[model samples]
Target: MSESSRWTMPDMAGILSNKIPQDELKPGDHIYSWRNAYLYAHHGIYIGDGMVIHFTRAAGQEIGTGTVLDRFIFSSSPSHPSGSPCPRCGDQSRTEGVISSCLECFLCGGELYLFKYGVSPGVFIAKTRGGTCTIAPSDPPEHVLHRAKFLLQNGFGVYNIFKNNCEDFAIYCKTGLLVFTNVSVGRSGQATSFLAATTAIVSSPLRFLTTGVSGLAAVGFGVYCVSRYVSDIGVRRDVMKIPVERLILCPGPLESEATTITDTSKEKGL
Candidate 1:
């Protein structure tokens, strides 16, 4: 593991899997980095001990040690099911989370839409597989925003379903802002609605997992994700730069000296 070049920091959440043997670690335990002794963070996982998996990142070369999460949650199935298909993405994406539980899909990246059927004007029952129901919409935008802030801060996917036909909402990730258009059942506005002035630089130390139109919408949202390395002063107050412990526990024997990892991405210095 070395300092990343493309990025200067590490951000994202969740790092562990069911196969890690929960007996070695449980929920609310400190995670340490095996590569860099100082790269450490706290997470909530551990169905037992030595078994925990959350979505996080490893050190990068060009990006300068940023998140590159490609993890599996179920330890029993450490290797992604081959031959089997991930008709969806969200459901197929799984890792562990300190505050999130099954937020995304364990199979496909497609989000699990929990839509309910309305039997009446004021009453409704969740027709989805989880037997859920709809609650009354928010009273005002401020209320919606406040609620959204809390949801996101608490490690939940903060989705603000505006109380109108417009499908517009702002997402506050632990890393950056996730704004989308046409994808939400809300209204349309410039990316400014979600992003503060360019100077605000709300580049929170959060990791983002985008899906569907959100990927396209992020460009419109104008949210920037700037990472800080271990040298950054006080950056750890908001969140740790890189989670070293999680990476050390990562399942992998270093690549053979003859092996060469390729940069398959289009981004520069990646």
Candidate 2:
């Protein structure tokens, strides 16, 4: 594909398979790679120079839920199987919050895939998997790089698998959008997928209408797709554009901070 084609809106096949070679990567690109046998993906911002900045938990604490899931999720940071620090990144396995690592270490033996933004609603739903793309458009590369680098110097608050994770970090860097609802999940598509699956299985209306197992399965899948689509940051109305500096200085939760800022704006009537 030509350079322009690579950046164009992806076709159905391209959307289904979003992999891109390393040579195509540009600064401020959101990239991810599957980890733990495709159980989940680790996401980061490609800020040029073969380095990635991502949010992660400390080693052995990727899953913050403190359940059996932790055993399976595994740390998303760079780790060498031979118990040696990566020559370029230097033992970032235990690093938490926002940190930088070389592209090799970031991939950690996984295949690299580009994250798509500004996708059509049809395309977003057609993707059975969440976290691969979003309907929101990305900001300019310079803005994205600035956010990533700023977070690296400060922090992105704590890492919560459901509300805040690597995917959330990358999404924020790319779009500067943050969920302002305290009860809702963050912008992480992986987290949304898990919730959507549970919602589908437990509360799908199709369960009441369908008698056959196949019918029930079809209903559940439809519910799952709808759940994922509506909860997406791009589609949700509960998000706000917040400056990265404000997030760093806020002493309260992100949602609360956003609310306070909104109220202040209202008082000023600007």
Index of the highest-lDDT prediction: 2
Give the top-scoring candidate (TM-score): 2
**Model 1 shows how many backbone clashes?**
67
RMSD of each: 23.7, 4.6
For model 2, what is the error of residue 260's alpha carbon versus the real structure, in angstroms, after optimal superposition?
7.2
User: Model 2 over residues 54-122: C-alpha lDDT tens digits?
Assistant: 988877789877777777767987875456898878888888889999998888888999999988777
* TM-score: model 1 vs. ground truth: 0.18
Distance from true position, residue 16, model 2, in Å? 2.7
**lDDT score for residue 110 of model 2:** 86
Query: Which 10 consecutive residues of model 2 have the lowest summed lDDT?
Result: 3-12
